[model samples]
Target chain A: MIIGEQKPLDEIQGLLEDAEKVLVVGCGTCVTVCFAGGSREAQILSSSLRMSSKLNGHPQDVSDVTVQRQCEWEYLDEIEKEVAEADIILSLACGIGVQAMAKHFPEKWVVPGLNTTFLGIPVEQGIWEERCAACGDCVLGLTGGICPIARCSKSLLNGPCGGSEDGHCEIDPDIPCAWQLIYDRLTAMGREDNLLELQPPKNWQVSRDGGPRKIIREDLRLISDELES
Target chain B: MSGKDNGYLVGSHLEKMLRAGHFAVTGELGPPQSADPAVIHEKAALLKGYVDAVNITDNQTAIVRMSSIGAGTLVLQDGLEPVIQMTCRDRNRLAIQADLLGAYALGLRNLLCLTGDHQIFGNHPTAKNVYDMDSLQMVQMVTDMRDKAIFQCGDEFKGQTAKFLVGAAAAPFADPTPFRPLRLAKKVKAGANFIQTQLIYDIEAFAAYMEKVRELGLHEKAYILAGVGPLKSPGMAKYMKKNVPGILVPDEVIDRMLEAGKEWAGKKAADLSPEEKKARSKAWQTEGIQVCIDLIKEIQKIEGVAGIHIMAIEWEKAVKPIVEGAGLYPRPEVN
Candidate 1:
């Protein structure tokens, strides 16, 4: 899942400074699970902005609404009315949600209120750690399920760099060294032979380097009138 | 590809020494946290002729410092060869390539591609990590720049591409130690010409690692420099054993340090004054240097070992003595 955190109140306030009508939109998916830009967070931010703006002697109108999942156009369509009513749409969702909202409502000025961080999942309550780099390729089978691209400080395919000490990364004592974990996991699984083979250079063209990627499942595509004709 | 195809930059004495099979000796210098060129020059000058090359670390341990390129340039000015250490923690490929070009233009040749220490380990725990590519990719990219005159993205270099006697790091003691040599082989295949390993307090473990490296015939592909460092004190040993990851400062070394302070240890812990404590620390530090010198000697006899990389962290002054004691001084004057 994508993890993100709301921008600081002052930065958001600065971005929304000139607006008289502000519409705060939230996402119910990843941001909700991470307790970031979800519905509750949007409401709290709306109230805080109202109180702060009122304190600053220029009270602005604020409205809050949440889409089921802001990344999907169908879910985002539910908030078209609220978005059209506001002077600006402040998306309290991941960066993708902001872009999706902007794409759906091309007229309104859509701004991101959160900084999208990484693709991660909750490691524990109140703690989330990155788990994937979405490198357009995966090597988990060879690495004992630990994603070196996401976890190793260097994303080294064949490491445990010299900095990895005691199963933790040299960068931080708390963050477990991804390579160390891979080595341990591979040893336990008795698949140590998998690591001996050198992984070839990653083809970045399949990753973001190739430019924005899209998935097309021709088999799953609906046959519209134009296609049928 | 062989080292010849690796396209080593001109005038790297370390490369010259390694290629000449003269038991290359290298040293590490962590550019100060502050931006003082004089400090860099002074520290580098300490190891000026003692070691073949000096490694200028890039924000090692994630602490912000004068950039490694900046410090390495100063090292060059001091008439010492500088191995510019580049980490993947802070820069994307564009910035990394740009910096490498800048470093090469400034007459620095040797480059140690590292996956830098995580930001969380440094003062800036909240800083976003920009691991655009891991060190493996970094090495491969450098190799491409040197060998093919092309970027990893397949764009041809306009002109005058940077050539480097590329290097990378190793952790012989990292857990699942059996696989460590295999990891080293991968780095070598990725284009590392030399490898400076993490601190080796356990010579037995390192010897075992070297055995695997030799068995796989990786030693023929890359120069393997065993990293050895002087411990400042028993407290320092304990701190590293507790905090620093991958480094195994064997309990025996710590026991030696404790023995160094037996005079002070016999008294009440609170009875010792600051000066007394400093004296005890001095004793431990002296013993630490002796131990490092001994380790270097033992490592020199190990099969597949190229040389020693003495990391006298912040104690650059101790580098010369350790090298002399270990009989690594009078570094070969490579053409």
Candidate 2:
């Protein structure tokens, strides 16, 4: 799941400066699961903004609405009225959702309320750790299901560098060494032979280096008659 | 008129030293956290003739300091070679390439590429980490710029390209010790000309690593310099064993420090004066230097080992003694 954290109140307030009738939009998906931009968080943010404005002696209209998934247009269409009525729409979604709001409501001032952090899941309640780098090419099967691209400090293909000590990364002694975990998992599975083959340099063209990525679903897209003919 | 052989101060002394089949000794000088050139010059002067080359660390331990390039140039002014250490933690690809160009333009030649320590270990834990490329890739990039004069993006340089005698760090004592030598081989494949390993205290473990290194023929691919450092006290030994990653200060080394302290206190280990305790601490450091000299001698005997990198750390004054004690004085001039 995509993980993010709310921007500090000062930054959010700066984005909402000189604006009246602000709409704090939330995502019901990843950000919600991570307690970042869910409906509950939106409510908290609305109240906090109201209090901040009251203390500053300049009160403004602030309200919130959450969509099932802000990235999809169909779910976003449900909040068209609230978005149109507000002077500014503060998106609590990831970077994708913030762009989606601006694209759908072109004239409205849409700003990000959350800093989209990483593609990860809750390791424990109130704690989240990144597990994937979305590098486009996946090598988990070869590395014992450990994502060195995301977890290793150096993102080494053939690692545990000399810095791996006591199963911890040299970058931070607190973080578990990704390559160490891979070695342990591979050893336990009796797949130690898998690591003997050195992995070649990663193909960056398949990753973000190629440019902004897109996916098309030919099976699900509506076919135009002219094109079909 | 290649950048590798020309326009570089000291003319790649380390490369010359290693290629001449001489045991090369290098030292490390962490740039002071404060922007004080005097401190760097003083330390550089101390290590000027003691070691073949001195490494200027880049934000070592993740703590911000005077830039390594700035410090390296100062060392160059002191008439000693400097190894400009570059880390991927703070710079993106473009910035790293730019810095390398700048470093080379300043008449510095030797470069040590590293995947820097994470920011969490430093004073500013909240700073973002930019591991745009691993140390292996950094080594490859430096090699490319030197050999092909092309950037990682295949862009050709209009002017002189940054040619470096590239070096990388090796950890022989890291866990799953059998794979350590294989990692070194990979770095060599990536174009690392030489490797300076993490500190060595356990000679048996290091010997075992060297055995693997010889078996794989990695020593033939690149010069291998064993890292040796003076442990200041019994407390430092314990801290390294418990907290410092990739370092194994064996219990025996700690026991030796304790024994040194006991000897200093005349067997009455308790109720010593503050002055007496200070003396004992000095004794600990002196004993630690002896251990370093002994370790250097031990490592020198290992086949395929090129030389030693003495990281006196903050104790710059101690390098001369260790070098002289280890019979490495009058460092070879490989002009």
**Which pairs of residues collide in candidate 1?**
A154-B134, A165-B245, A165-B246, A166-B246, A171-B118
Find the candidate with the highest TM-score and give its number: 2
Candidate 2 Cα misplacement greater than 4 A, ranges: A4-26, A31-66, A80-116, A122-128, A137-144, A170-174, A185-229, B1-11, B155-161, B263-274
Which docking category, incorrect, acceptable, medium or high, applies to candidate 2? acceptable
TM-score of each: 0.79, 0.82
Clashing pairs in 2: none
Native-referenced Cα lDDT, model 2: 0.88
CA-based DockQ, model 2:
0.39
Off by over 4 Å in 1: A2-67, A70-118, A122-129, A135-146, A170-176, A184-194, A197-229, B1-11, B33-35, B123-128, B147-162, B266-274, B332-335
Indicate which candidate wins on DockQ.
Answer: 1
Evaluated at residue B109, the lDDT of candidate 2 is: 95
Worst 10 residues of 2 chain B by lDDT: B1-10
Q: Cα deviation of A149 in candidate 2 (Å)?
A: 2.3
